[model samples]
Target: MSTYHIPVMLKECLEGLDIKPNGIYVDVTFGGGGHTRAILEKLDGGMLYAFDQDADAKANAEEFQQHRSFTFVESNFRFLKRQLRFHGVKQVDGILADLGVSSHQLDEGSRGFSTRFDGELDMRMDQGAAVTAKHVVNEYEQKDLIHILSAYGEVKNAKTLAAAIIRARGMKTIHRNEQLREIALTCAPRGREMKYLAQLFQAIRIEVNDEMGALHEFLEQTPEVLAPGGRLVVMSYHSLEDRPVKNFINAGNIRGKQEKDFYGNIIRPLESITRKPIIAGEEELERNNRARSAKLRVAERVQSK
Candidate 1:
């Protein structure tokens, strides 16, 4: 992999939190420790807890000193609140989650998070996770397949693609990218193979990891865990992930309904740190095209009256 992690909007994220020397912080995605390392530099006696589900991430822990203030948790960040509680900490100053697959996962063909590579269709963020791209292709029913393709991938011919997978599974297994691609080709829009295939793979990867589900849980707990005036810096790479973030931030709840008070005024739990989600600057885009889709939403906790 050329870059282990190309931290998107590093400067912007750092500024979003306005990190304090004594404040506690958490980096939910510790891919290559880029954000964790950056957070570490800004802390004096502050505690930094880094979490990554991939066991390989533990190997990268050697890059930083085993400091008193820094600790690593080899688990999913979806349990951000529970894990923090284990450390006997509450109400952190800030929390950062760079959601979805890491650059290293995509860059390495074996992990198969990207359509660019022809590796096995195994896209489990945590290797221990039971489901994989193979399971989605071979096991899911037509309707469920369509749901995943449309919900996570936004694939145009979702029903057709789901039908194809269903028919193909009747004959034999579709395990690797090559086999899945061959089956998907029949349903994919002709001359639009790459994008369509990418969508399908993305959909499978999201299901395999439960990325959106986990994000929802974390966001639900955000208001409770963050200190008053605490910051949440989240970077989402696509609409599937960004949409919920958009909805949850704009309104108090993910359902997008206004929370009415006695006066019928909408009571919101969060105030947008940025009126609009921040995007990568041109220079950053030149270095990493992945930054093109990255949408950052920062919010501060609002105390309930």
Candidate 2:
């Protein structure tokens, strides 16, 4: 499990959940089962439902299947509410989502999740998914590409990058990571080639997986699925992912809009547990560089007054 991917801020995530010995819980992003394994340990009579869309992640979860309390849901976390209902689990004590691509995904060149590796342009988290990064790079319109690059990846030269991709693909389909990388390099800034490439790749990957859309859908369902006072512990890797998590926790909506009651009391489903997000300690950071960009926020489900 450790080799598959180290669970970033493992201790912090556990603490944030405030685990109860016999309470039901869910691990929404069961990549590598690192977090799921830890959560299972804390359960005595409690049930733990682990969800993942990746085929590799399901294989990693096989080790825990024999355990009486563990149930692996082979689906995207975006279908959280419906899946829980199917399992007769209307509400849960806690839901922990470790967002973004796993270390295993990035290290495997064939997955095309890493800019460092030259491989197929496929970046589908669900291997069976219809869309791939190759499709997005070769088929998406220039304006659409620009929007994803700018909004999802925060790429500084989105317009130039999109135009370059459009021009290159017009001559031939962009079918591999290297092909797209070369086109992106043409538009990259002088000294920030690596960063620019990463942003470009991130944008494509996000669109291929519909990451932002899935995230918004998943966040909207959390309040409905979590039992009152239940914890919503999420660790996001980038601002694009982190912003919505932060907003949902603080304002009860993804837009960060706070609806109030007639008396002016905030009408929200969750309350932020900490004033700021929790960061990994130096010890953890040195051991795991992935934790460097991670921002963890914990919020408890609350009923409106």
Report the Cα lDDT for candidate 2. 0.91
- Give each model's whole-structure lDDT: 0.84, 0.91
Highest lDDT: give the candidate number.
2
RMSD (CA, angstroms), candidate 1: 1.6
lDDT of 2 by residue, 1-305 (tens): 67889999999999999999899999999999888888889999999999999999999888888999999999999999999999999999999999968888888889998888888999999999999998898888889998999998899888988999889999998888888888888888899999898888888888998898999999999999999889999999999999999989888899998899999988789999978999989999899998999999999999544
Error of 1 at 112 (Å): 2.8
Q: What's the TM-score of every candidate structure?
A: 0.95, 0.98
Backbone clash total for model 2 is 0
Off by over 4 Å in 2: 303-305
Cα error, candidate 1, residue 148 (Å) = 0.7
Best by TM-score: 2
